[model samples]
Target: MSKKNKKHEPHEEHNDESWLLPYSDLMTLLLALFIVLYGMSTLDAKKFEELSQAFNAALTGGVSVLDQSTINGKTKNTPTKEQDNQNTSTLTAQNMTQLQKRNELRKQEEEDLEKLKKQLDQYIKQSGLTSQLATKLNQSQLLITISDNALFPSGSALVKPEASALAKALSGMLQKFPDYEILISGHTDNVPIDNDQFASNWDLSFARARNFMEILLQNNKLDPKMFSPIGYGEYHPVADNNTEVGRAKNRRVEISIIRKYQDPDSQVTITP
Candidate 1:
């Protein structure tokens, strides 16, 4: 019985599946790499140390990798509240020093003005010109008041020759205060006058102020820029216009030494 010659059937080869194990292992490693990179990118210093400590605990039974980086047993670059307060105190001290300097300068100015006033009063007493000349110091200025009869003739704008001496003396006194500004102001009584020399009190008062200012400017040491002339015709009177004595007081020339320093309360701020 020749079993119909055993047909040698060829066995089919099966595809090998062993490579899947390594592929899955590679995928897991890549995922772990991506997670580590993401954690590194977002971690702050404190959180980064915490994460490192966790890794250390898992790997080495709780030894920390960040233990050596701590300095002076504290975090670096963090200022305490006391340090901020010290900075503020330094600024306050500087402001107080500046305020003291300003106050000292103000006091010095007051002393200088008082000395000038006393000197002017002494001159008026010595020259027996108290009735004709007077000095008054107020908040805005030191004013030297001269009577119309002392400086000019009736109905005249021209300064009298005798008054030149007085003007020269005043210029000499004013030379000591080169930084001050001088204003020459003329005032007239309410009486109306029409004459060949002047048509109105305005014209007369302005001319008188200008002429007197010219005398004051004769000193070569005086700065012309520091002086000004103004005329108030029958206006800004210090006395009543109805009486002769008041009229005489009203008709006068004033030399005002304007104060360079102004009081804080009276100061005006001009906005542009």
Candidate 2:
């Protein structure tokens, strides 16, 4: 009985620290939440994209557009064919402007050429030499024929002293134009020459051409380089060889003014 009583009377002192267990558990939970938030903030974009795609595949039914694609929050549209046509039209307008300018310049040049031709015709008519002198117009040149009696002496190569006034009148008109080429040619009748000074018609015809060329060259107003002289001794006959009237016409000098253009009006091309 004494042993049992001693065992029961033996008592232990209790320490109370139960609140620390719950507090430790709360701190551990807060630490875990902060770590999860940090992981979300520093997420890898590529892996995150793959994870989001897998999530959408598991849930969504429609193909949705990417979030960042809607820049300026506007709907995208395709370019129209009309815009391309307008660009082409602008280019065409620029080309047309250049063409118009070229066309205007060409017109101006042709007008100048026509006026020159008219001036030459006027001078020929006003000099009262229209009958003996004739003008032949064509695409290549303008030919003016003056009789031998008007330009030179019989069987002589010398250009007459009085011819200078006539040549000056012609040269003064021609000096203003440098764009054309001038040719003075001499021709003779079929009859043979019997002069002591020259042996044949060829010599006389050539001398006549040379003398006329010299006269034109001496004119300070005319350009010497554009003038050329040629002789045809009864070879290039313009009229019948039988009649005296034809022979007189054949034995003459001719002046040619070459044309610079085919026509007064024509189309022009322009490039940029």
Candidate 3:
């Protein structure tokens, strides 16, 4: 009886390897789980497509494959839905920051434009030169027009005595704002000009513009670096030169103040 009991005990010892089969399967499943996570972290489009299709075909409803296996005899695997939702939230935050920054820039530009308009109005009123001056405020700059009848003689670039005070006043005000670009532009009516000093309207208009630029520079109201003179001899007409009123309006010298990004439309810049 003792010998028979010993043989049974050895048989029981040989069958103990049954426990190891299930343990081996558990270890394989764990290895597959880690491999799937690593692949997701460094995914490529081709492999992702293959994996997605294989997992979908292996599972019900193409998802929720906790009990499903792949063609390679491995279980389906992926992150939880909650984890994907968190990643989406992070992306949304980054997008919102970019939009907010753009809005801030637009707000700043609008403020600048309004400030320029206010300054232009005050300068015109304080100088008491409204009768001789016409002011235009646009998205890019401020344009102040002084009629040719008020500034110079017909077909001549010579500055009149009455125009001296007007020019000086404008120059003084401009001197206070040195950060602006000042453009002196000359225009002429459609009337022809033939003279010893100026052969055509173009010459007359250009000379008038250049002379005014020099005057502004000499008076310290403009910096030579930020000043330019252009002549549009009968080319840019504010009114029809055929009519008396139009002719008067067309024959003009304009001092344009280019705004420096304070107008809402003038600043298309980014923080970077």
The best candidate in terms of TM-score = 1
Provide the clashing-pair count of each candidate structure: 0, 0, 3
**What digit string (tens of lDDT, one per residue) describes model 2 on residues 98-168?**
97887786565556556766776787788887766776655456667788988888888898998888778
RMSD after CA superposition, every candidate: 9.7, 16.8, 12.2
Best candidate, lDDT-wise? 1
TM-score of 3: 0.56
Report the candidate with higher TM-score, 1 versus 3. 1
- TM-score, model 1 to reference: 0.67
Question: Candidate 3 residues 59-167, lDDT tens each?
Answer: 3346634235342333345544576799889899989998788778656655654565566677668877666666776666667788787878777799887777766
The candidate, 1 or 2, that scores higher on TM-score is 1
Instruction: Provide the clash count, candidate 3.
Output: 3
Q: Which whole-number lDDT from 0 to 100 does residue 157 have in model 1? A: 87
- Collision count of model 1: 0
Instruction: For model 1, state the Cα shift of residue 54 in Å.
Output: 19
Off by over 4 Å in 1: 1-91, 267-272
The whole-model lDDT of each prediction reads: 0.80, 0.71, 0.71
Better of 2 and 3 by TM-score: 3
**Against the hidden true structure, what lDDT does model 1 obtain?**
0.80
